[model samples]
Every structure is written in C-alpha cells, then in structure tokens.
Target: MRRKDSHDGPARGQGGGTGGSGVTAVTGGGETGGVTAATLPVFLFPSELLFFSEQRRCHRRVLTLYNPYSFTLDYKMLCTSPSLYRVLEAEGSVRAKSCVDLVVRHLNVSPANCGRRDRFRLEVRGGGQRGGREVWAELRGGEEGGGEGEEEEERKRRKPGGHQQRGLQLPLVPTAVRPSVSQWLLCVLLALLCAAVLMLPLHTDSGSMVPRCLHVSTNQKLACAYTLGLLTMVFLR
Candidate 1:
C-alpha cells in the first residue's frame, strides 16, 4: 500500500504529516464528526461569483454564488430551489463557510430543512482527504455524525504518515466500459454494416424489379452478399 503526505489545514505546513493529524473545531448546535476544519482552495467561474450580488439584483432577497466545487447537493432541494441550483451551476469557488451562510440566508432554509445539511460543513473542517500535490479533485460526502472518532483513528492506524486515501469507495459494481480502440472499431463496423444494408437492394435484382423498370437485386440475395462481405471485413479487421 502506498502512503501519501497528509494535509492538516492552511495553518499547517503545506506538506508533511502522517495519518489523521488535524484538529477541527465544531461549535454549532449540530452533530460533530471527524472532519477537521480547513480552508479548501477552489477555482470558480465568474458567473458563480455573482452570488454576492444579492443587494444589487432581485433585491437583497436573492444572492447567488456558483461553486465550481460542488457541495453535498440535495437533488430534491435543488429541484425545489431553481435559483439555488442556478447559482451552483454557474461556477466559482468561495469559502465553504460563506457558502453555508449564503445557503441559510438565500434559501431561508435551516439545516433541519436540507438533507444532509450538516455534512456540507466539510468546509468548516478539512474532513476529507487531501494529497501532497496541489491538484484539484472531488470528494464524496461520508455519513453525517457518528463513527467519526473511530473512523479517524482507524484511518490513522492504517497510515503511519498522515495522508489518508483521498476518494470514495463506490458501493455499486462499475459498468464495464469498452476500450477506446474497441469502441472505435465497433462504430466503424456498424457504420459499414448500415451502409451495406442500405446498398444491398441496389446491387441485386428481384423478379419485381424487371416489371417496374427498376434494375435492382432481390433483398434476400443482397442480404446474403452483404453478410458475407461484412464477415470478411470483420475477419480482416
């Protein structure tokens, strides 16, 4: 198993720590977990930044900011809140703390109203894994509340160095994806097959063709020939 350097937070040195080595303080009336409080760096599109324009447009009532980095989004909430979705879809990065505040104010929503609301507080503490490299990536939200202390310790025990594995383990079996070359070849073969099928009748004559002044092959003979040609081409490929 390979080990990576862990990220403590902005306050900690850029790189250099071993397994589960960060302190995050949680002070809200909500449940606490193992995530450490840290500032996450994110790139944002200009459209997302317009979330701050609450005072200017749509009155002080509507303020939108699109986080290029997504949060734990509730699809149901999103469907209900089109404006919020629009802000998130526009794109840009802001402090997670600020985002939480914006969410509270803009949606007039309390944590109780949002699904997995407390989990979005990953911004409050650097709860997820970060690597030594300054690369950007997405993290799946873990369960909210409970098992955090045990999980963190388990994570630490697994790694002597502070770096934790930085991704989610998908629950479902992954669909098999065809190799790119195979996919391309299949597309080409299909296209050729379609073209051959289309042209088959034109190249062969049917008994009906002679009566209509149409010079064309019968569908059955054309199909056979097309099949043979296609098989030959496939074998060659």
Candidate 2:
C-alpha cells in the first residue's frame, strides 16, 4: 500500500533588520488533505493469492471485488509479470452494492518457476476519486521431488516380472433396452392379430361380418387376454 498527500504552500517569514533592511525565509510545511490507500472503501476477498502447480498444469483462481457504496465503481487490474499470467475481465464496472469476480490464471506453471512471487494492483475510481491496493501472488509446489516420485512409480510399473494388482473389470450394461424398428413392427402385428381375435363375435345369433369359424371360443379368448397382457408389459418396459 502507498500513501499520497497534498500540501497547501511553503512557509514564509519576514524579519526586520537594522537600517530598514528586510530578510525573508521560506520553510517546508506540514501535509494537508492527504488520502492513503487504506482509506479507500474497496473490499477484496483473499487479499493474497496462492497457486499450486503440482496439482494441475494450469492453475486458476478467482478474485472477488465488492462495492458497498451507493454509486457504481470502476476497477482495473495490473500485474507485475504480465507475460506469465492471464486475467479474465481485468477491467469492469461494479454496480452499487454488488460484487464482481475476476479470474486469474497462471499460464506458465512448471517446476522451473516454482515458489515465484508477484504483485498485482487493483485500481478503483468512483465519485471523482481514485485509489488502489496491492495484492501478492505466490506459486508453490511443482518441485523436483514430485517429478522424482512419479518417475519411481513408473519404473516400478515397468519392471519385469513385477506383479501389479489390477482393479476388477466389469462389463457395462445399459440401463434401458429400447425396442428396434423390427421388434416394434412385430409388436404392432401381434397387437393387430390379438385385436382381430378379440373382436370376433362370440355368438352366431348376433349379426357380424366375420365368418362362423373365426368366432372366438372360451379357450381362444383366454389365450388372447394372456397375449394382450404380455404385450402391455413389453410396451411398459
């Protein structure tokens, strides 16, 4: 954080000397109307940022900026090492009583640059006034130890006659079995045949266009009912 101060003017004094001669001197004065970085009402979450490169190749972190004032606030982000990092939505306006999220990504994360430190500046302007705050960023992990451990495990796995336990392999089964086009057509034909058998007139006394031999009997009616029940189950399944 930095401090800024404003001064009115330099001190001036006049002294009377012998023979009507005058002597004047100027001196520094105290600071007045000064505004410090801490005086700003900007709110930032996780003032310090940390990235673990050993966890992933690309590391990303979110920085939140909150505006509690009644008026909107404009903000901009500045990085000390611009080439090694990327910022999403680096500059934006935050509405009154709202917050905005900025994504910071470490583009170059490797073992060579571990434990690196950088600084970021968040400058805010609102209500004809400007202020800024500094944030520290550090990259950790991704050391030679992690790489050596991975290499040791690989060597063990590649060793000859070294038995490595394998996980149980299970065949994947589908949750639901769908009927194909041919199966659906077969079902429709079976439904039509069942409907025709059930629609046949049971009594010869009743006038029906169907022939006498096609009339449904008691046993045939039971078989048709069973077939219809089976078709219903198949459709529901």
Candidate 3:
C-alpha cells in the first residue's frame, strides 16, 4: 500500500533486502504469498510427530488450525496407519478468520514397531467447497518416557537417605580370607555362644538356681553378659 525506491533481493543477514515486495524469512526459510493466504489453513505442530514417551497409555497432542479465509473451513485429519493412532477431535469446522483445536493422540506403539516414521494428513476445504487443500505432517521417533513407578523408582535412587545405598558388596580379598566364609563361621559360633549364655543360671547369694539353668559363679555370670552384648551388636550391624 506504499511506494519505495526498493526492490526485494537475495536476503543476507540483515534488513528487509531490496525489493518492491516486502520480504520476511520464515524460521526454516520460506516466503509467504499474500495471494495464497486466503486459501491456506495455518496449522501448528511438532516438526517430528514421533513419540518417545510411555508415561501414559495415550499421548495427547493439540493441533491448532487457523482459517485464513473469510468463510468457514471444514477439515479432517487422517493418517496412513489409523490403527496406530487416534484423533480425540478428528474433524471440526473453524469460523472465518478464526482458529480451532484438534487433538492428535499418539497411541502406544509396540517397542518393536517404534522408531519408524510416518505421516498424517490434514485436509481442508473452503467456502464454495469446490476445491481443497491437503498437508501432511511427517513425524519421527523421539526419546520415550518411562512407565509408572519407573521414574519414581529411579528418583528414589537419587534421593538422599535411601535403600539404594544398602547394597552389600563382597570384599575383594583373597579366597582364603573370603568374607562370606568368615561371616558364616562367625555366625555359627555366635549362635552357639548365645544358646550357652541363655542356659547359664543367674547366681544368687543363697546359691539357688532354676532347674532349667546350670548355676554359674559370679565371674562366669559377667562373661555371659559380655557375650550377649557382643552378639547383639554383631547382628545389628
């Protein structure tokens, strides 16, 4: 709507180049045609439709479709492998110059069937419905998310004060001095010691003892108590 001494040219790293036509470069590089805007539908989505997440049974993705026309537009989404995916709101009508939402749900793909890329088509028809426009989005596989309890269990390992730190690793000592053998022997000895300690009778000033327990001298009584204390400590460790 204005005149200038300019002409659009090969755009370098700078100003609106030199051209009669106002020039703007898209993110990935493209030129928009004013003539085509009236017939085109604007759609937004991920560059790669591949899903790597498994946190839910279905991956919900929202597709925003805008109608640039002066009249309402009717559109439907379809995919080559319809069985592998679902559209929560597959078809819808958008008011003139307004936008509507379409949800493209990515169903769970089998592990073996994953990582394969596919395309889904969006078909749109304008006012007179005499002609139409079709665009396909290509989706590639992305990193997957974990299932339930999987992420939580991993977080537990990273959190402080955990069962994760309770792992028991055997000593790398020589076979002759292997810790397992030593522990087994020690456990057996400790068991016997505890039984013996329990059977010892408490010494009384009158030299009386229960029939189930043998009477022990005062010195022996002290030794029995020491043994019991040591056994408790070992088991706790």
Name the candidate that leads on TM-score.
Answer: 2
Better of 1 and 3 by TM-score: 3
Supply the global lDDT for candidate 2: 0.65
Measured on C-alpha atoms, candidate 1 has an lDDT of 0.32
Question: Candidate 1 on 67-174: residue-level lDDT in tens?
Answer: 223332111111223223222211112332223112222333333333322221222113352211011111112322332444666768677566665465669988
Q: CA shift at 204, candidate 1, in angstroms?
A: 9.3
> Candidate 2: which stretches are off by over 4 Å?
1-39, 142-237
Task: Evaluate all candidate structures by whole-model CA lDDT and list the values in order.
Answer: 0.32, 0.65, 0.50
Candidate number with the higher TM-score (1 or 2): 2
Model 3 bad stretches (over 4 Å): 1-41, 129-237
Tell me the tens digit of each residue's lDDT in model 3 across 156-207.
8888888677566788885443348778688768768766755666656344
List TM-score per model, in order: 0.16, 0.45, 0.39
Count of clashes, each model: 23, 0, 9
Decreasing TM-score order of the candidates: 2, 3, 1
Instruction: Write down the RMSD of candidate 3 (Cα, Å).
Output: 20.0
